[model samples]
Target chain A: MRTLVLVFHPDLEGASRANKALVRAARELPDDTVTVRDVYALYPDGVIDVAAEQRLVEAHDRIVMEFPLYWYSAPALLKEWEDKVLAFGWAYGPGGEALAGKEIAVVTTAGGPESEYVEEDGGATMREVLSPYRMMARYTHAVWKEPFVVFESMELSDEALVTTGRKYQAFLTD
Target chain B: MRTLVLVFHPDLEGASRANKALVRAARELPDDTVTVRDVYALYPDGVIDVAAEQRLVEAHDRIVMEFPLYWYSAPALLKEWEDKVLAFGWAYGPGGEALAGKEIAVVTTAGGPESEYVEEDGGATMREVLSPYRMMARYTHAVWKEPFVVFESMELSDEALVTTGRKYQAFLTD
Candidate 1:
């Protein structure tokens, strides 16, 4: 299946390491099968071209949303994409069938460790944190897959990022 | 206690009746006690002023985030505000005591009915969908209150909106 990876990071080259590495790995996939779009680069002004986005999604069988977790969710621009691109008639509601039957996945890197996400640690589990996306996928009739998360991103060494990137590549292709 | 209600509707004056009513009710409060900010109007370009936002939060003992729910979450600009204004060392990590002991509450209106938000209906409950905000409040050392939700917004009559708005005013003050 053709997979489209929409990477949404404000400073992918400057402030990010793990996400960049992951994107690089995703890019290394055979060109015919995977298409990677750096959403922030594409829309620096924060205005999304709804038609273009819908067309891109229609072209792909699997949609992977890659980003760094901000406030336990995707960046604002990504949210903007959802608000603007995923319209009522196009993505859901009465006549919305554009995204139906497509597969949706999330790949996120978090600065905090996995243990910090539990209730005992006073933080929410990844599942609870990502519930909105899950529900959105359901509402859009897209098949939601389990998320791929890179935890404790701040502590990962260069070698560790490469290892995780390799794993991410396998996950995307699998 | 001084209350700051950051209203993040894309268009409060237009395309919104319930939210406008809510804001009007909020305005009826004593001017010295409550500050209502139209966030989207303040930043038409989607750029948030971090320093000003921090100062606004600092000035208030209670913070109420009022918005029309988009895809089961706050609007994109609100997410942008969270990503930018709630920075490291200011909202979390070390020395992030600016919001400590402050009360944080969410007041939202949903186009869908309350029944659509239940697990049996293949959607997330309000608590689960709003978990990220609750966790963010906890992470920032702020007090998290039960969210105030207005359901079936599209069907609410003008009279119903006024009643709901009055209740919203009470909720913010209480």
Candidate 2:
């Protein structure tokens, strides 16, 4: 299946270690099987080309959104991509079928440890943290995949980063 | 008590109905008690002024983010506000006490009906959908208020819109 990885970090080249490493791993995959797009680099002005994005979505069998969780959500550009690319007539509402039967997945790196996302002690579980994207997939009739999360993203050792990258590569191919 | 209502609608005067009404009602309150700012109008280029926004947050006892729900989240500008304005040293890291002890509330309008958000059959409940903001408040040590939500917002009757606005005004003051 053709996998499209849309990376949505404001600074992939600088100030980001895990996401850049993950992107590098994804890029190492055969071009025919995986296509990686640096979304923020493409839209520095924050204006998304709706037709082009929709076409990319249509072409891919599986869509993976890769980002670092900021304030428990993706960055502004990713949200903008959702608001603009996922248009009413094209993504939902009557006659919207671009995303139907396609698979949607999220791969996020969180700064906090796994324990912080638990249900106990009034904190949100990982499931609840990702519910919005799950619902977004459901809204468009897209098949949702279990998200891949990297906890303690900021403090990962170099060896750990390599392992995580390998795991991400496997996740993409799976 | 001072309240800051940061309205994040892309078009309050043109395309929106519910949010415009809500903002109008909030504006009708005494200036000393409530401060309403049209965030999108303030930053048409999607660039948020972090220092000014920080000053505003510090000055208010309650932060009420009012926005129309797009893709089960606020507009991109709201996410950008969180990223840029809610910085590490100011909002979450050591010595981050700007939002501590303050009240953080979300007042949103959802295009989908209330039934669509129920937890039954894997759909997200209203609480689950708003969990990101809830966690954001916890991260900043702010007190989280029960989110104010208007369901079936796109199709609300004129009278219902007025009622929701009044309820929102009460929510702000209380």
Candidate 3:
């Protein structure tokens, strides 16, 4: 299946380490199987091109939204993209079938440890924190898959990064 | 108590009726008791003034985030504001006490009906859908109040809008 990885790091080249590693891994996937689009690079001005984004969504069989967790959610630009690209007539209202039957998943990196996300651990569970995306998938009638998350992202060693990268690539293929 | 109402409608004067009514009600509150800020109007280019926004948070006892739910979330600019204005050492990490002990409430209007938000109704529960914001309040150590939501916003009658407006004003006071 054709997989589209939509990366949403504001400064992927400069500051991000974990997300950049994942992006590299995603890029290594066979060209015919995977397509990676860095949204910030595409919309530096933050204005999303709705028609183009919709076309990309239609072309992909599986859509993976990749980003670093910010303020317990995806970056603002990603949210903007969702709000603009997934319009009423095209994504959800009557006659909206742009994203139906497509598989949707989230691939994200978090600064905190995984244990910190549990309610008993004084943090929200990953499922709770990412409910917006889940809801969006439901609204669009897209099949939701288990999200791929890498925790303690800021502290991942080089060895760990490489391992995670391979695993991310495997996720796209598997 | 000083209340800060940050409005997040892209076109506050043109597109939304419920939002306009809510903002009008907030404005009717005593000026000393409430401060109204239309975020889009202030930052037309989506370039947020972080220092000014932080000051607004610091000065308020209760923060009200009012918006029309787009794609089950606020507009992109609000997320941008959260990413930029609520910075480390100022909102959450060490020495981040600007929002600690403050009350945070959400006032939102959704195009979907309340019945559609239940798990059995082919939609997520309102609580589940808003868990991200709830987690944000938890991270910031802010007191979260039950959100004020107007479901089936597109079907709101003139009288219902007035009632919702009055209730919204009371909610701010309470």
**Which candidate ranks first by lDDT, i.e. highest?**
2
Candidate 3: segments with Cα more than 4 A from true spot: A121-123, B121-123
Candidate 3 structure quality by residue, lDDT tens digits, B124-157: 6787777777778888889988999999988999
Interface RMSD of 1: 1.2
lDDT of 3: 0.90
lDDT of 2 by residue, A67-171 (tens): 999999999999999999999889998888889999999999999999899877668998898898999999899999999999999999999999999999999
Cα lDDT, all candidates = 0.91, 0.93, 0.90
- The digit string of per-residue lDDT tens for model 1 on B11-87 reads 99999877898899999998889999999999999888899999999999999999999998998998999999999
- The predictions' CA RMSDs to the true structure, in order, are 1.2, 0.8, 1.4
Q: Between prediction 2 and prediction 3, which has the larger TM-score?
A: 2
Q: What residue pairs clash in candidate 2, if any at all?
A: none
Using DockQ as the measure, which candidate wins? 2
User: What is the Cα-based lDDT of residue A94 in candidate 2?
Assistant: 87
lDDT of 2 by residue, B1-174 (tens): 999999999999899999999999999999999999999999999888899999999999999999998888899999999999999889988888899999999999998888888888778988888899999999899999999999889999999989988998899998
- Deviating ranges (above 4 Å) for candidate 2: none
Model 3 residue A135 distance off true place after TM-score fit, in angstroms: 1.2
Candidate 3 on A70-169: residue-level lDDT in tens? 9888899998999889998888889998888999999999999988888674456898788789889988999998899999999999999999999999
Ranking by TM-score: 2, 1, 3
